[model samples]
Target: MVVTVPRVSGQVRDALAAAALAVCAAVAAAVWPEVRPLDAPGLLLLAGVHAPLAVLRRWPGRALASLVVLALPYHLLQYQHHALVPAEVIALFGYAVLGRRVRVVLSVVALLLLTCVVGMAMRAGGGSVREQIAVIEGVVAIAIAVQVWRSHRARVAAITERAERAERTREQEARRRVAEERLRIARDLHDLLAHSITLIGVQAGAAAHLVRGDRPVDRGELGEALASIAATCRDARTELRGTLQVLRGADGGPPEVLPGIAGIAGLAEAARAAGLTVVLDDEGAGTPPPEVGVAAYRIVQEALTNVVKHAAATTVEVGLARDGDRLAVRVADDGRGPAGGSPRGFGLLGMIERARSVGGTLDAGPRAGGGFTVTALLPVADVGSVTPR
Candidate 1:
């Protein structure tokens, strides 16, 4: 998608070339007849050599080839070389620009042999050897000059291609870093809000029900629940600010304390407050890396959040285990399954992304027992031991 117009310098060069070709054609037409006998074949050869110059830029190889094919017979049949004969040298240069060097070299050698043979024939029929030698020298000098020109152009083109590739590689890296940063910020936001919001909703509902009922509220329990809700809100707000500050690049690094594998208990408590009976069992080996920990915590948190919103289940089970080089997590709920259920939305999508980011795999679907199950196998401290998916 980018269109570039010709530079003024290039346009000027093309104009000058067109003008020069026109002058050559005019001079050849008017002068060649005066020098040699006026002939129809000579005029046609003149036209063929000059006319192809117009299309040299568009198809330099083809135009040069045509000129060479036309020139052999034109020079051979003609009784003597005319002023217009040097036009073939210009075609040779054009061929060097767009064609192969070996081919050009071969062509020059062939032309050399042909000219000497013609000179021999001319000598046998009354011609001069010295003039033929002069022609050979001119042809050799021109071929050498054209080869040098082609070498320079080839070098310049190679340098230009290398620079373009470097620029493209830099651009792709910048885009990739930007995308990864955005994903980190998003995962932070989801972890902070999903669990806290669910807990706050449950606490608020309980407080409302207690006040609305005929029973006198236990002021201490009511106060404690409200305090918990306030504390959760405060933490959520601070976490959000940290996440945003990181996104803006004002923060030094990730929030010093990201919720990790250890924080799954809070997710369970939040589910309990939301009226889901949650049983959590964590059995793992060596500690996971920070990135893997964050991913694991977020995956569990999101799974529980989905249960609170859609499952309406009475019992939920959460498990974490480390086997060999992998960390495995499973969340199963005994509720109405995904069939005839509301779309799970971006929550599951985010969990899947989290899993993959840490070189993990996720599988979430309805269980055969009329519930839903979300299972993930993630690379943890032993990430280097496993090949990337």
Candidate 2:
């Protein structure tokens, strides 16, 4: 199959470059004395000087070799005909760009120096010594210019390559962080909806049953169930709204009042509303930093939610205390836990990840006597925040 190249930036650059070479060649040939006819040998020699430029960018070394052989004979045979022979000088520039080969460049410079010498000797009868010296000076100036231009081009190419690599690295890092944020949001929503809705479902189902029972219904019991349902829904709504705002990114205003060690009492109240009595004890020094506070709040919240869902217990004790540099939190329910001392679900996994994010640790298992317990130790440092989705 034949391949076609699309006109990308690099291809466009090459086209502009080829056009520039064509212009240079035409200018070089245009200034010669009375132009030779298309059929004359002089015109053929002119083609040898100008035609190789068409491929100079693609094959600079070969073009330099060819231009040297062609321009040498033309200079020696017709030194007095044109004021300047540009082909050999232009070839030096092409070789400068396409190579780091010092030997090849030096050889070409020596060849051009030889041409200037031979041309001056041949024209000694007509041109003065000063004029001959001036010609050699111009050739030396051109050689120095080619060397300087080549060094600058090499430096620019190296710097450009380094810049491109850095840009690519930044893009890759941004993509990776985005993927991690999306995953965190997915997990937070899962925990919030799964645990909150389960409690709401239980309370709502109980309220529905009592109102429609065969026997005379107790107004107080039905009232408590309905109240619990309402409270759960309110908590879910508030938490979901705050989480969405966090996901949208922070606006420079007062931070949302998130759950922390102080919020454990509120969480206990919520659990108590769901028909379980929860007791809370606080022994920490000052308020924990927002990160430690938030992780502590989530740990307690998740544990109590588990108690309501699976514990089938009557009372839960929530405790918070500062142990040296760590804020330790514990939630123990006097109800039967899973026989294996572990819950096979993302709930425990989310709790563990939360603790780890804040440079903390968590342990949960069945108590020796009866119920289950979740204990966590959170560091009060700038490890990271466990921000909700």
How do the residues 228-278 of candidate 1 rate in per-residue lDDT, one tens digit apiece?
A: 788778867776776667566675655536667887887787677667899
Best candidate per lDDT, number? 2
Clashing pairs in 1: none
Off by over 4 Å in 2: 1-58, 62-84, 100-133, 147-188, 209-215, 244-256, 275-279, 310-317, 332-345, 363-373, 382-389
TM-scores of the candidates are 0.74, 0.65
Model 1 lDDT at residue 220: 85
lDDT of 2 by residue, 318-362 (tens): 999988888889999999896577887778888987888788899
lDDT of 1: 0.71
Q: What is the C-alpha RMSD of each candidate to the true structure, in Å?
A: 7.0, 7.4
Clashing pairs in 2: none
